[model samples]
Target: MGGFFTPDPPPPSPPPPPVIVTDPEAEAAQARQDAIARNRRGLAGTIATSETGLLQPSQGVGKSLLGE
Candidate 1:
């Protein structure tokens, strides 16, 4: 009988593993571009912070360099 004598069907075979290919030269170029962009952003941030500080009022604005 199907219920008593039939052996269970073998488990379905696992799916084949995926293959990935990469270009080392392209990857290195991309990394270099990213680093350059990061540096630009850091410089921009520093400039922005300095500009913002200059625009804000501070107690030291009128004070002399000699503490007069």
Candidate 2:
């Protein structure tokens, strides 16, 4: 491969931009906000399907443990 001769190497590229650093406090606040929103959505769903609607729990006799 290098038996003959190789050309000069290319010039070095410029340095990359600065790295982005995240704030731990801000990250924690965002996580807490997201969790609160998720819990609110779940509560809304539970209220919609609560026993107050036509889907109330059955107060009938309990199932027998033995195969009577």
Candidate 3:
């Protein structure tokens, strides 16, 4: 009879709580830094394309400012 019966252990407890804080100044500074990095990347890409002479006008666009 003992071999046919077995006991199960209880489930584990939940995890601990978390701490949260808010800082507006820090958030603004981070945003500014991110914008600067993005701008730099864009400028670098433009310069690289120009240096490689990859920029071209579309066909039949214009040969002169007046389209002459």
Candidate 4:
């Protein structure tokens, strides 16, 4: 068989290098501050509904039966 007709194997690739950071604590503190600011902007308060003006027809009968 001719060398030109034979298939050639591919070359090996180099491994990836590790990453090094200078300030890990500073990065964590900044992330916490961002989360707190986001939460404050989306916060909401609940409102209570009043029923003082609404009347029920059975209230008088129920009170008389119970001697209230």
Best model per TM-score: 1
lDDT of 1: 0.77
- Per-prediction TM-score to the true structure, in the order listed: 0.50, 0.43, 0.43, 0.35
* CA lDDT of every candidate: 0.77, 0.75, 0.69, 0.61
TM-score, candidate number 2: 0.43
Q: Candidate 2: global Cα-lDDT?
A: 0.75
Name model 1 segments beyond 4 Å from true: 1-5, 43-68
lDDT of 2 by residue, 1-68 (tens): 33448866677898999999999999999999998888887745656555555366656656646775
Q: In lDDT terms, how accurate is model 3?
A: 0.69
lDDT of 1 by residue, 8-32 (tens): 7778899999988899999999999
Error of 1 at 66 (Å): 29
User: Cα-based RMSD of the predictions, in order?
Assistant: 7.8, 8.2, 8.2, 12.4
lDDT of 3 by residue, 4-30 (tens): 466555668888877768699999999
Per residue, candidate 4 scores C-alpha lDDT tens digits across 1-68 of 33787777666788788787769899999999998987785523121322332322445433454455
| Model 2 segments more than 4 A misplaced | 1-14, 43-68
Evaluation by lDDT, superior candidate among 1 and 4: 1
Residue-pair clash count for candidate 1: 0
Q: Which residue pairs clash within candidate 4? A: none
